[model samples]
Target: MEHPVLIAIRRAAFTPLGWFAPGPADHAPENAKFLILIGNTGPEMFRRFARESGVATKLDAWTREAVSGLAADLGATAVYPFDTDPPWPFLSWARRGGAGHVSPLGLNIHSVYGLWHAYRAALLFPVVFDLTPPSPGSHPCETCVGRPCLSACPVGAFDGAGYDVQACAKHLAREEGQACMARGCLARHACPVGQGFAYAPAQASYHMRAFLGARQEE
Candidate 1:
């Protein structure tokens, strides 16, 4: 049966990607009935909402709070992509069902949004809802003529092996990488699908700066 909470959750501006029951013998809260994978349109949409709300927190913190607020209204709980204390396995979750695939870039590529989207939150709810696995949307990587995402990185951050975090950060710190740091990853932009959903240049730049700045502080 369709749950009113799910409908309400969608109306609150989150896409429900996957639905599944609590695992066997799990010590999860008795009230938690299902795990719901949720995502937003993109970081730009989220940032706009944050700006309109007049929040003063950093973007990541602000986004988590905003999604949590929506979950609270539905008597559910929201956890973010950034959570790591008891680190959430969001990529694994997304790969398992109707969500999407782990791309050559070592990122989850949604069928509709490809690599251009952001997964803002994961929700746990106390209500029953659809248990059928969602259609794992058409994979763009499967039919691409040359798979440009594999070789588009100037620094080779993505390759036959996988994504190199340190290599990517080091490159972004250099003058040559300024373009990507200002407009988002070149490898990500090379994907054929979901160009329409790509993050705006300003939004991409904001995130790129934050990413590079965070690594330097470490």
Candidate 2:
């Protein structure tokens, strides 16, 4: 029994609006019926939609309900939220079950857009869609053995403990982060995949400035 929403998701995947990026793992449960691949909305789009929808007051809860409702309407047996932090217990359960991939807030090759990409939401359907996971294995960082991202930082913010957000904020405070904030967001540009996924320099600068300003406020 092919699900209608699953079909819609497949069609959406290839369309310009879908923004679908393939996942690394194959989700083939014996009872699995459909697979829905949802991609994150760009940062700009998220802001715009949130403002216009007037659901701004309840954005977070609204997003969850919308996804859950979509799954229920589609008759999906399971729903997976990719690329964002869901409840910790749900995340643990998903990991133990081998259902999907959960990415951190920092760098990843699969999404060259980097942390700048906003994961507004996602809804995975249990309808089988016959799509193959990305091959040649996952984790593009594996090929970047020297880990250029670690060295590219002007302040060594990405030390052994992932990204040093406070250090990065402090640096960006002075001279508006002349080293990495300008034409060289090192970690972001370092990503090999989705080179075309980069936000415009002006857009990047705006975000950098906002992030730096927010950090100063903190």
Candidate 1's displacement at residue 212, Å, is 0.4
> What lDDT tens digits, residue by residue, belong to model 2 across residues 1-218?
54455465433321111212223443333444433334343444434335555422444454455455555665653333432443323333323332233333253224334333433233444444444332323545545566666676777887645778898888777885775666547666665555665666644665576677668777
| Shift in Å, residue 39, candidate 2 | 3.7
Question: At residue 152, what lDDT does model 1 achieve?
Answer: 88
Tens-digit lDDT track for model 1 on 152-197? 8998888857778889899999999999998899998999877888
Which pairs of residues collide in candidate 1?
Answer: none
Which ten residues in a row are the worst by lDDT in model 1?
A: 22-31
Candidate 1 stretches greater than 4 Å from native:
1-7, 25-31, 53-56
Which segments of candidate 2 are over 4 A away from where they belong? 1-37, 41-106, 111-118, 124-136, 176-179, 182-184
- Give candidates' CA RMSD values in order: 2.7, 7.1
**Backbone collisions counted per model:** 0, 6
